[model samples]
Target: MFLQRVANRGIGLGTLLERAARRHPANILVFDHDLDAAPQLGRRATVGEAADAVADLASRLWASGIRAGDRVVVYKSDGFDITLLAWSAARIGAVPVLLSPQLDGATVETLMRRTGRPHLVTDGAKLQQELSEEVFDASQSVLLVTGSHPRARTLGSFAGVERVAPLEMPPDHPTLITHTSGTTGVPKLAVHTGRTLQARFRPQAAVTAPLRGRQVVAIHVSFVHSRLVTALAISLLRGYPVVILADGGTAHVADLFAGLKPTVLEAHPNSYLQWEELADDPRRPLSGVRLYSSTFDAIHPRTVQRLLAASERPAPVFGQLYGQSEIGPSVVRSFSRRRRQDADGRCVGVPFPGMTDVRVVSRNGRPPSAENPGYIEVKSDGRIVTYLGEDERYREQVTDGWWRMGDVGYRTKWGCVHLLDREVDLIDGFGSTLAVEDRLFGRVPQLAEVVVVPGADGRAVPVVCTRGDVPLDRAAWEAAVAGLPPMAEPVQWKQADLPQTATTKIKRLELAKLLAVGAGQEA
Candidate 1:
């Protein structure tokens, strides 16, 4: 609705490329394969070449039975292929859905069922294993194979449809239909327009590295999520040679850095935290990276220490800051060493150049003072596009153009803002707002990992782990925890190796699910 009401929005991704082509036709646009690994000029395509490629892909999609507004899903490992397909879908007003390639066959099938996309653009093997013949018959979904898919029909097999005809798309055309992680609940689709994404990126263009030759590593996972969205756009717009990590596991990142030697590393703090465990690893130090950025949460103190120690050169370029799907491709950035490593919290750096307004708000939805942590609400140069089916969620979340990201943090005594926790993560067990496991981990050193959630017995419980030796020092641990406020202590503590997300974060929802399942078994 917000996008529909806006004016002069360009046709999402393709038109942007058309404009880019017009400005710099010969400028190198994208570099796909890793120079060190597969070493191929993945594509030396200029803006003009890119635009032409989109048209070619559009023709290909149309021949394969896709049409305007129809969903075209991409679940592949290659980021360059994803970009080309996404751009092609945009060229024909098709809703491009990008998904993580790591998803198993069943998950991919389920997602396809949910989107009801008539066409799936993936390579051969996935088609044979994941997609059922019945499901294919039901939707008449064409499997367009790019790489070696063992079970795919050739492009010539589907002949009657028009090859590649360019279709006009409105400015508010939806280029991307992305989904949240759905770790806590059902994954909801968020539709983004050309304008929404471009406006978000334009401000960041000035703040981020110039769109030219640079070795950039996309450390984030590709799951039709905002983080991947930013990484892709930054790579394309900045003309950076991207090194896509085949694996995003905590253990794999160090190897990626060592092999690729990227100039810029776009990473989340969870991975950085895991890097802390390798502080003494001989190859821990990051080389070639000029700017090291951490997003999603404040860099943990341990992680900061590791990074500080790992830089090959003196005074490693390190910084941490905030951004969300709703308001920022460029939200708030802190480059200063003092602010970057300030675990106590500070401004998320001054707002990006075009960010209009950002503030700390109370639980009741009113603005809070610099010292009081509250929800982070932002009014940016370009607000979010909108949720697909949940229009009310959008309306309620965005007030006077400021998007209320559910995070709770306060502005520092200075201009910096500090995020405490998210509203959903704070349990109301005994009526006090507390960061459940986050607080406990800080208190208990013996615990290697912990996840606190509402237990089946209608009380808060923390599932914990230790390095080894089941030292049931419960009395000591409880006494130490008792010093914490009532809300901070867990009513029960269960011991186990903590479950982590693919991104290595403790899966709180999965933990809740496990608790519910255990309750069901007991019953």
Candidate 2:
């Protein structure tokens, strides 16, 4: 694997952005909201203008007392302004943490406390409504707003301070931190350095199908973990016109493709699978999309097939990527229809061009056999610098040279890798081991989405959402589920629209809580 044996690069993410700015100063760097929206900031921000703005912001942030190694949380959805802030923070050597704008003040507080940084960068809405007036008293650090929406403080306070310009830093400098949507417990923050990010983007960096200097519409939220850091960055770095839709949800995934005609479409499985509802429409959902890629969790193979079939071209434009916050973006990728046929929907293609190594190992540390599954260990130049607060956990994750990802997978007889599931998501029930996804979707029909979740009582069941309003024939679904091996049938089924993460993954933990509340009410 390309990610395993390679050496680290000395170049950091700050240097990369500077390189891009110099190469294409006049070109359009980022396009926010819609092409026609006037309130949008990046409506006309050229590369030179964006670079200058980032430098200006960086300088102001530093002058306001933001420092290198200090944690700065960015609580906004995907847009030109927020991303540019991220670049600005990196240039100034500040570690900017990406958080969901939807996160409540309590959750935000918890995250802020974890990094021991009281400063935050957020929109005007959150500062007033969610954080309340106390956010200023809650932290000793400064709060900077993204736009003119009246945040905790105005940007004009530091008038004459020199703008912090981009500078070269070591590749191992901690640039970004994101929490993984863990299956079993609270999310863990995965750190990534500039070197790790470069390795992840190298292979697909040159492939600009959907976002090739074309108008790109991103519905994926910035806080949804890996989408923004991985797939979305690939588009932004290419100088594509990025239009981030703030109001859209999974329901609008197909619409973004059809309406925007993006050269490429990057979304999550749940978002793409929902397009099955539009299958009956004579018009194609993703009519003008040149490439469609998905990452985060494994998108079911059936979902991938249906998405391909539903597209304007029945041929596969689907790309499956494997990535993590700790390891930066995608280190592996599998693309095309033929490749889809051979995939189980969980194989995140091969290692990217510069990724050092990726491997599946058993308990003994040797490679696992074809029939055996083990922890996935990868070593790359692009791995994270360190965890935010969990130094011990971070150390345990790093072995001799590889980072032991808690995911369980093994290679095929032909040497292709297949993810069985995350080790954390394994459910021990009826003395049989199972992945929640395998039990739920394998038994359901035409399922737009499903989550195999552990109930309050520790029993695992299915929470499902279908594409249409058609009532499920309970008897048929029950019989079909019953026919599966005993371990596969969900203990109970609760059908409703399943909630999704920003990246379009079913938030099983959220659903489980919902289902638990419903169960309590029934009792």
Candidate 3:
């Protein structure tokens, strides 16, 4: 069945789910957080059940006047229902724009305005709060609330609606819209078509084909992101029973893993950093994990080392994919116990031979060499067509066929991609913040995370978090940074206080702002 589907010209995003349901009727589709629990637990559903739910919801959306080519905005807290509803909208040929609930009301409002006031699907509680705060404009949108509200129509009202047949869309029809993490500025909505999504998932499916139906897969990432959709496709197509984790707190993940004992685990890098302590936990939550996958950003070597060691599986592997929201996964690398200790976190491996073309072009237009690092550019078939409502901005980043990655890095003599820093976050005196942070990892065993950001004087400053308030060893720190740039006295911050995107990447701009304020108080 899978072989036949792959031969099709293009598969619609909604069709993918429907096919999965037909192929694996009793296969589990979702494990959502239980609302009534003190320590939240998950509730399970089979693929057929989930497909029915999507059809029911799609009918309600169509009854609400949404039609082909119409836009529907889904703004809700993290939950399986958010993903289900997004796919439901797609099933009816309505483009679904998924916004993270973690985004502030102002950001949400800004995104809504840019999308031209589409129909909004949100919970009554969130709608009321945003409305009361004057951040959301009620007059511009028709509200579809999950819970009862005076000003909105409840989703429950359409619960009894008959299931509607899935709509057929052209391969290039826009099906999903999601925003960037907003690390630099207001997030831009990235538009994706079914063809683009299929392009992205094809490579992933090929690589993991060997593990199909044999591994229990567990995922803890933002449901609203593009990666989640790809993940769902991979799990469903491969017949892997999935455990979706909405709450990524260490305790919740630990509890879930203890019960499920997944053999394959995928999450944001920072999430793995937070779970390093589980390596030592008596429960041994990660013991059964054979594969650990991280995307979005480069992960620290120490974090990777610890996780690989935690897995009792003899040959545990860590897979890292370095790419952006605009383009799908570009470069890929795998780490095993043999290479764990000597792994350079900055080296993100080479681009897939046929999947992408990568180049490092210097500021002066010279070809990149090891010594002369420059901005990284990539040309991939899976790249997004354009940013919704920002064609000019999108075009600015694309020159000819290559897309500027907004990153500064150089390719090694062996063709590996070594990331230095985000173009905006590069500290003038410091070579690479990621490289510096990697060096600091082993120097202080208790240091959980260390970030180098520009200070008020424009010099590099290190902000660190130690495990359980372990005092920093001044002598060790001085020795570790011996030949490196002179850094400002390290500022201590609680791990939870560091601002991060939904993908678990530290907001370097925000961190710099925080440090500058601290410098002022000291003065």
TM-score of each: 0.74, 0.80, 0.93
Superposed Cα RMSD, model 3: 3.5
* Per-residue lDDT over 65-105 for candidate 2, one digit per residue giving the tens place of the 0 to 100 score: 87777777776544546666676677778877776655666
Per-candidate local distance difference test: 0.57, 0.58, 0.79
Q: Please, what are the lDDT tens digits per residue for candidate 1 over residues 61-140? A: 77766788888777665455566677777777788877656466666666667676446776655566655555464344
Worst 10 residues of 2 by lDDT: 30-39
Number of the top lDDT candidate: 3
Superposed model 3: Cα runs more than 4 Å off: 1-8, 30-32, 35-42, 131-141, 340-342, 365-367, 469-475, 519-523
Evaluate model 1: give its TM-score: 0.74
In model 1, the worst 10-residue window by lDDT is 32-41
- Clash counts per candidate, in order, are 11, 14, 0
Quick one: best TM-score, which candidate? 3
TM-score of 3: 0.93
Residue pairs clashing, model 3: none
Residue 177, model 3: Cα distance from true site in angstroms: 0.6
Is candidate 1 or 3 superior in TM-score? 3
Q: Output the better candidate (1/3) by lDDT.
A: 3
Ranking by lDDT: 3, 2, 1
